[model samples]
Target chain A: AQSVAQPEDQVNVAEGNPLTVKCTYSVSGNPYLFWYVQYPNRGLQFLLKYITGDNLVKGSYGFEAEFNKSQTSFHLKKPSALVSDSALYFCAVRDHRDDKIIFGKGTRLHILP
Target chain B: GAGVSQSPRYKVAKRGQDVALRCDPISGHVSLFWYQQALGQGPEFLTYFQNEAQLDKSGLPSDRFFAERPEGSVSTLKIQRTQQEDSAVYLCASSSTGTNEKLFFGSGTQLSVL
Candidate 1:
């Protein structure tokens, strides 16, 4: 089976400070990784995805994630945190053999001003 | 119209009552999906439809859950004999292709079973 793990339930970062939200995955075949953000009382919004090439993938809102094959990790990062970046972040994976995407429990990010 | 649209943003149902949730996908989207999200958890896949075909229903929790996209544009998910465990946010998403690409999601219908 395929699964995603987000180690942290909540991450707090000060404004203008760098932030990182960790994610790891397990899949039988190749994995399609993605990041999504959800604000309170709203639906999830797509952030970025890592399909094949370029381990470093850039996403919306000045966010990026590095895909490490050996580590089986895809950690979302931002150079500087903003108060508006506070939201729930989810890491998802889709196995090549399946059409369904599985998501992690989600990490709540709080950017303190 | 501009994005995936779901009806009845909130629904309250008594135990043993049946409820129907509706979804209207984006124009020309070929793939639609239904997901259930419990409190503080990620969305769980309930079913998938390609056009008018019900391609996958493996993630459905029980036989009481039924979903269909008759004309291939709008879809409905009906739950019979509602239980407290079934109380969650039912999310509807769509993509242009059949593959599980970047999906556009609706605000979702928050269901509460008493």
Candidate 2:
């Protein structure tokens, strides 16, 4: 089974400060990791993914995530937080053995101005 | 269509009533998926279709939940005897391939069962 976990239910950060939303996973094989963001009443939008290459993957809206195989983690990060960065974030994982993508319980990010 | 589109953006159904949700994927997308998202939770995979073939439905909660993507384009999810637990945002997504392609999602249909 492939599973992902978002340890924090909600994260608060001040504007201009760096923010991190933590995520970890469990998979028997190599994991394909992804990050998605969702605003109220809107569908989730893809942020970034890690398949096989670089440890750090940059995504939309100045967001990025680092894939750590040893830690089984793929934490979402931002250099500096903005109020507009507030949204629900999800970590997902899929392995080659299954076509289904499993998502973690979401983390709500709040960037205080 | 420019993106995956779902119909009945909001639905209110009495318990035991049946409802059908519709999804229109982007043109030429080979993979379509249905997911159920409860409040404050991530999207839970319900089913997957490749073209017109229903491949994986292991995530469906019950036999009352049914889905089909005939003709390899538009898809429909039918729920029989709606229950309060079934109230959630049903999302539809599509991708160019069945592999590791990023999914394009719809705004989702919010189903409220009373």
Give me the candidate number with maximum DockQ: 1
Fnat values, candidates in order: 0.70, 0.68
Clashes of 2: 0
- Candidate 2 lDDT at A6 equals 95
Model 2 Cα shift for residue B29 (angstroms): 0.7
For residues B42-101, write the lDDT of model 1, one tens digit per residue. 899899999999888999999999999999999999999999999999999999997767
Candidate 1 clash pair list: none
Residue runs of model 2 more than 4 Å from their true location after superposition? none
Q: Score the docking of each candidate (DockQ).
A: 0.78, 0.77
Candidate 1 on A8-47: residue-level lDDT in tens?
Answer: 9999999999999999999999999999999987888999
Which tens-of-lDDT digit does each residue in B12-66 have in candidate 2?
9999999999999999999999999998889999999999998899999999999
* TM values, all candidates: 0.98, 0.98
RMSD of each: 0.8, 0.9
Per-model clash counts, in order, read: 0, 0
